[model samples]
Structures are given as structure tokens and as C-alpha cells.
Target: MVNWFWKRKRPLTRTLRVRSRGDYGDVRRVDFAELAPEIDTYLGQAAYLQLGFFETLSDLIAPTPELSQKESLSLAAGAALLKHRALVDVIRERGDDPLDVMLPFREPLDTFRRATHGARPLETMLSVQITAGMLDDFYLALSASYGATGKQVAEILQADDDRDALVSILKDAIDSDPEWSSLLALWGRRLVGDTLLIARAALGSQALDEEEEARVDPVFTDLLGAHSRRMAQLGLDA
Candidate 1:
């Protein structure tokens, strides 16, 4: 298990603009030196995280009884695997062995996967949608720091996740049983802490000094805002 620690300081009122090129064909960019990691660190973590999502989604397929649902899960799983492979190509183009770059992150991220896995399949499905959405946004924000390579990564992250099926599946679950509405909502809320910790940890530190925190705060704020919108889209309270 990954031990989690978070400290809340008073929010700072500031506007930081990040131009995102890959999301919805928007070609804008911003660089954050204080929060960005070395290029290898960023690439390795992003690649492995996508691979992890693929593995989780793949695991969900067999036990799922409905053929149409299985097909939907396969699409989402394939998208995740495609993103993972695309990231690996980026790593290879840099002349680094993909495994060498990705190895260090395996244990911690696997721990993160386990920690976020839920008691039921629906809870786990929401975990993939929410965590993947937030982290994909986080990495896209960090992509600007790496210039052209970052742009390529941004494009990869922005690819269609085909996770809308998961959303419809969840919404149906909630609508079918009023009980699922509260259960999944609570699961969604519980996910934020662990998910944020994974995002924070990817910055190459378990702890950040106050100055670093200040610079990183707005990016995370944006992540949380996107997260809430995703939860609401599922008809659940964030």
C-alpha cells in the first residue's frame, strides 16, 4: 500500500493560463518549470499508467456477462493499450529502452492501482474513468514543459478513450438502483485523494516546498474542476 499524506494551506488567488494543444484540437502551450519533471520521468509514468488502465479494463471483461457490455469494455481497453503503445514509441525514439525507462515506476503505480480498485466492478469501472480522466489532464498540462516531445505526448493522451460506454453503464447502474447513486458517488469522492497523490507523486517528490506548492496548486485545481464535471456527467455528486 502507498501511504498518503496531504497538507492543506490556504488557497492562493491567482490565475495561471495553460494553453493545451491536444485537447479538442486546441494548439496552445504553457510551461511550468516548478512542477514539471525530467522528460524521462514524465514519459515513463504516463506510459505505465496507461498500460495499467488497459490491464484493469481487460480484467473487467470476462466476468461481465453481457456481450454488448463486453464489446464496450474491449473498445475502452484497446484505446488504453493504444495510448500505452504510442507512449512507448515516444520513449524508443529517444533511444532509451522502454522497459528501462518504465521499470522504476511499476511498483508504486501498481500499488496505486490496487489501492484504488474498489469492492465491486462498478466501483472499479468508475475508478478507471475518473482516475484516467484526471491523470490524462494532469499529464497534458505537464506536456508543455517538454516542447515537441510533450506535444506528441499531449496528442497521445488526447486520443478518444471510448470510456463513454463506462459512463453510460454507470449512469444506467445508478438509475436502476437508487442505492448505486450514493454508493458510486461515495466511491468517486474516495478516489480523489489517492488519485491526487498519484498525480503529486509523478512530480518526482512525495513532498513539495511552499514555493513549489504555490506553482503546482492551480494545475491541480484545474484537475479537480475537470474531475467534478466528469462525476456530474455520471449524475453523481463529486
Candidate 2:
């Protein structure tokens, strides 16, 4: 991932408006400097992240006892897989091997997945909902920097994730046990820092100067706003 943020300070005026599409209604206009990873890096990370989401959701299916819940999770998993394939196709169109592009990110992202995983199934489900939602919004914002490829990536991400079913399942769990409300809320809060780190890392920088922070803040602010709504919808306080 090449650093797109030049160290020199400059007054930031660039803005990217992420239009609401499909079930991606929460994405909004955000102002940020022109910052993005290299196209291969962007496509690789985005592609693998979707694959991770699919794997996490699919893993949950076998342990899930309810047939309806299994089917719902399956749908969401399938959506993630479809997005992954779409992204990989884009990589191929660019003449890059998907595996090579994605390889460099595998370990760090896998570590991230393990860190976000929960001891219980419901908690893990919330992890997926909150984390995936935040990262998707982040990618949508970053997609604007890549021109035609960005548009293609944005379209793939905007497709209905079918995660609403997971939300319903979570709501049912909370309704049955009020305790879930607090537990999941706590887990959701814990996810923010880690997810934000991943978002920042995607910018290919480990640290940002004050000017850089100012430029990047609005994008993160929008991400958090959308994140809070997602938590609230699931009856969890973020």
C-alpha cells in the first residue's frame, strides 16, 4: 500500500460524496483530502475483507441450531462471497493476480479477524454487523479516489448485503434476553478502535500529523455516525 498522503501540508478542499444505493442508505457525503491506497492495494484489501466476512458468517452457520437463522446467515455469507468475486474479477481485468495482490494483507487482516471474534455466537454476529458496516462505508468513501475502478468497486459494495436478516436475529436474541443488549453494546464499542485502525492502515500510514488528522476526521466521523445507527437498530447502545 503506497502512501497517497503527501507529507507537505496543504489546505484541504477535496470532498467525496458517497451516494446512498441499495441498502447502503447510511453512507453520506464526507469531506477528506485526496487519500487512497494504490489501486492494487485498495482492490486487494477490499476483496479479502469481503472474503473474511463471508468466512466468518459461514462458520457461524453450522453452529446455529435454528434452520431459519442458518438460512439468513447463509444469505449474508453468499452476498459477501459475491462481492469478493466481483472484486477479484476487477483485479484480473487489471492484469494482477488476485492471490498475489491479496497475499500481503492476509496475515494482518487475519489477525484483525481473530481479535474481533467473540467468545459467543451472538457477540460474533454483532462483530460482523458493526465492523463490516463501518469498513464498507470506509471503502465506499475511498472508492471515490480511483475513478472508473472506484465506481466499479462502489457498485459491488452497494449491493444489498442481506445483513438485515442478521439484524433481525440479533433483535430476537435481545428480546429473549435483555442481558444481550449490554453485552453486545460493549462488544460493539470495543470494535470501533480496531476497525478504525484498519481503516487508517488502508491509507498506508501508521501515523498522521495534525494536518493529516484534520483532513481525515470527517470521514471517520461519518463512519461512526453510521455505526451508531447500526447498533441502535440491533437494540444495542453504541
Query: Once model 2 is optimally superposed onto the true structure by TM-score, how far is the C-alpha of residue 154 displaced, in angstroms?
Result: 0.5
Q: Which candidate is the best by TM-score?
A: 2
Candidate 2, position 38, lDDT: 72
Residue-level lDDT for 169 in candidate 2: 91
Predict model 2's lDDT versus the native: 0.83
Q: lDDT of each prediction vs. the true structure?
A: 0.82, 0.83
Candidate 2 lDDT by residue in tens digits, 95-205: 999999898888878888988999999989999998899889888887887789899999999888999998999999999999988988998999998898888877755
Show the lowest summed lDDT stretch of 10 residues, model 1. Answer: 7-16
TM-score of 1: 0.89
My TM-score estimates for the predictions, one after another, are 0.89, 0.90
